[model samples]
Target: MTERQQHKRRRGAGVAAGVLCVCLAGSGCAQSGAAAEDAREGEAVQAVRSAADALVGARSSKARTSMEMATGGTRVTIRGEGVYDFRRQIGQLKVQLPQDPAGTPDQRPIMELLAPGALFMKNRGAGVPADKWVRVETRSLSDGNLVTGGATDPFAAAEVLRGARTATYVGEDEIAGTPVRHYRGTADLGIAAQDASDGNKESLAAAAKGFATDKVPFDVYLDEAGRIRKVRHRFSFVNGQMNNAVAVASTTLLYDFGAPVDVRLPDGDDIYAGKIAEE
Candidate 1:
């Protein structure tokens, strides 16, 4: 791997670890050695379901996210820090991008603001102005394509767990020094994404991409209070012209529930009036 690739990999791993810390600190898991062995199959699954409910019902949270994927022979890795507010249905992310080997020097990292109706992206590169933020309509994002969109929502992890066909307790593990119960599942992607998207599909190709595999694996960790602490998953797809693209995501929830999160819109002078082409 090149230095840039190695750097991205390290950052991705760091984000993963950071997410664990967020989960542990947010949920405030206490150390209890017997809780792991005392867990019952049915009870553990129910606890996970309850945690999923709480996560979906949460108002706002701080999150760290990482995704590494290959699409059409180009590998892309993204690491992000952000806060999501379900009450406002909006979030803002500071994203780190790999340097472009084929571009001029001085390209800055990107910033993204996501809302239910729109996504705003700001990047400094050739042909793109430094002061403008590109506006993207999110209707196409409802096509269940993680690449195109859908991962921005903090509740996406809980939705994945709710759609699991089989959820198995995987014992306990320490995340950021806090004890948590681990659960693994094979989730039906169609159902999971559809649930997240409300079954809206603007692009048939994008909607069908995840169906290449009827199911995908997901893991979740829960604190003793039955609240979700962290989630991790790997996703792969091969269809149309995408080749065999694969993505892995690790997300950690931070702070207590109902913590205030403010995601303000960009100033009018800084907002670009033009629309972005579909991803």
Candidate 2:
């Protein structure tokens, strides 16, 4: 072979090698970018899972709650305001029900005392004496008192995030004038029950079984301290009366961290034992 022809062949080989090197380098860069994205997603999920613990660190906070239920083309909204003690797993709320079909004047608000394993209510309007409180076991309620009480317990609502299966950091936002990071996710109720504290274990487990699906979709906002400023959960359960599924959207907003919350349970004598009328 001619020397010039040999030199040209060598040159061609070098060019081919260079092209292969560039392709490999590009692949490595793509992989690195994907790995970084995965790491960011993992951090967001970890932040969300730890939000409940952050609230516990804050001790207590003032809260506002709204629960909207839709069934058979009818929708009703219930609102409540109160204070919660995360450490004690207790709180108090005054819940106002929507107006009746006749558009009657607003009814007296139902005063509720929320505890770890029990719930107490006065003026519940089921034939119980107004002066007496009615006590119910949290685990006994089909929805685990999440829907029955007309408001989700603040701490319990936070605990639900413990089961976040998938999460994405949406962006920064403000809630009630406080800067917060918004996250969207879906949580598994069964998984939440497994990781929940002893006081909430049975109740959450019951909710997991009673709901139409164990999956709960939620949007949560967290402050700089990783505390939950707001959370909204969408729950669905079968309505026994209508023999259809009812959709419920429950929202809880927390602010005024370090607020005083004094929730005293009623004495046994102060609770009514009579058969209560059904709604």
Candidate 3:
């Protein structure tokens, strides 16, 4: 694969791996293990629910947030360092990669070692194409979740995501050197963007072109402390049959009590350059 493709794969893997760390609180193997996993999972789910609320109340220029969770047979973790650039009118979300697959959070991602600059600086611009196509590039970390920086997007959505099912806490378990409680359940995240006309046509198109044409669903998990443990995401992409399924699995941890996260808006040149490349 090309270096760019490799980077995208690596970053995607990192996010999934990082999320796995905090999201999935492992279950006990035998009957005893199952009981242990159940005990703490409920608490973990509650913690995440509360943290999501706290994020909604925060307004910081910069901060760090992490979450952990578990889904069907999978553990995910995600870590992020957010930078708010007022001049730019956006937030710079820097996510680290997972160091250990067994459930270690990405305290540090070797992203720099891969390459820098606007990951898809050469794409149809700073955002996806407006035509609803699948354009994969080595972009920077996400401000929070699937969508970019905004209230209705993944990061902001988490803060006000109601309709969450009660979680059952499982007991503590050790993963990648960390001890955690486990929680299990599916989170029905009905996210609707308030403003779908943010001007990032390419980006939106690219993202939208996939799911509808294919079938995808959202799966979630939590840790013993009620923190998000894992998220198993399966979606349809433009290259449905030929390409592997487009899935995002993540975990979160180390939430910043009430810190605000700033997301930087892409500049004119970033988008223009990407458009030019596409042209």
Candidate 4:
């Protein structure tokens, strides 16, 4: 070939080689990026699954709870404040029911004691004397006490994260002025029941069977110590009275780690055993 022709061929070959190199590099980088994303997702799932254990490591915390039920264009919210001892799996809450449709307070706040397998309530209305406490087995409740209690047990709420089937880190946020990492995911109640602690396993299993769907969607925030600062779970169940499904959102906020919490169960004599009236 002539010199100029050979030079032109050489230039074409160089250009083709450079293009091939760039293409190969781009493919490698794309694969690496995907692998990194997978690793991040795995880490997030592991972090959420272990958040409940982190609460136990903290021992105790003061908690605030809210449960909102919406049906037929009406929304009612129940609020509670309490302290929980994660290690002992016990706590106490003062739960306030919403006002009646007339917007007048009809009853006093109920004092609740949460234990391993039982729930105790004072000021529980419906023809029961305020002085007598009513004891209910958590396992016997169809909603597993998650909704029936008006407020979810803080420790139990955290335990729900143990069943996180999929989780995505949703960036950072603050709860009550403390910095936290947010995560969103869905948890299988059946899976959560299987992984839950002995105290909560049966109750969660009951909830798994009672709820409209086994999957519960949740949003959770964790502190630097990996302890859950705030968690919200969405649950749906058929409301017998309404004869329809009710959507309930339960939120638990935990703070003041290592807080002093003392919970004493009611004595047998203090618990009312007569036929209880239903509201």
Candidate 2, after superposition: displacement of residue 231 in Å? Answer: 0.6
Worst 10 residues of 1 by lDDT: 199-208
The residue-by-residue lDDT of candidate 4 on 29-129, one tens digit each, is 99999999889888998999999999999999999999998756889899999899999999999999888887786569999999987899999988788
Where is model 2 poorest over a 10-residue stretch in terms of lDDT? 68-77
Q: Which whole-number lDDT from 0 to 100 does residue 121 have in model 4? A: 94
lDDT head-to-head 3 vs 4, winner: 4
- Compared to the true structure, candidate 2 yields what TM-score? 0.95
Off by over 4 Å in 3: 1-51, 58-90, 95-166, 172-181, 191-238, 241-244, 254-279
Lowest summed-lDDT stretch of 10 residues in model 3?
Answer: 110-119
The sequence of per-residue lDDT tens digits that candidate 3 reaches over residues 1-279 is 699999999999999998886456442236567677666666545554554433334432343434343434455555655443222223444555445556656343311100111221121222445432222241222221232211112333233223234455444665444455544443433222222222222233344343333222333443343333333333333224444433443332333333454333344443432333432
User: How would the candidate models be sorted by lDDT, starting from the highest?
Assistant: 2, 4, 1, 3
Which portions of model 1 show Cα errors greater than 4 Å?
1-45, 56-58, 71-76, 100-107, 124-126, 142-145, 149-152, 193-211, 239-242, 245-247, 250-258, 266-279
RMSD of each: 20.2, 1.5, 22.9, 2.2
Could you tell me which residue pairs clash in candidate 2?
none
RMSD of 2: 1.5
In order of TM-score, best first, we have: 2, 4, 1, 3
Candidate 2 structure quality by residue, lDDT tens digits, 217-262? 9999999999999999999998987777788999999999999988
Error of 4 at 31 (Å): 2.0
1 versus 4: better TM-score goes to: 4
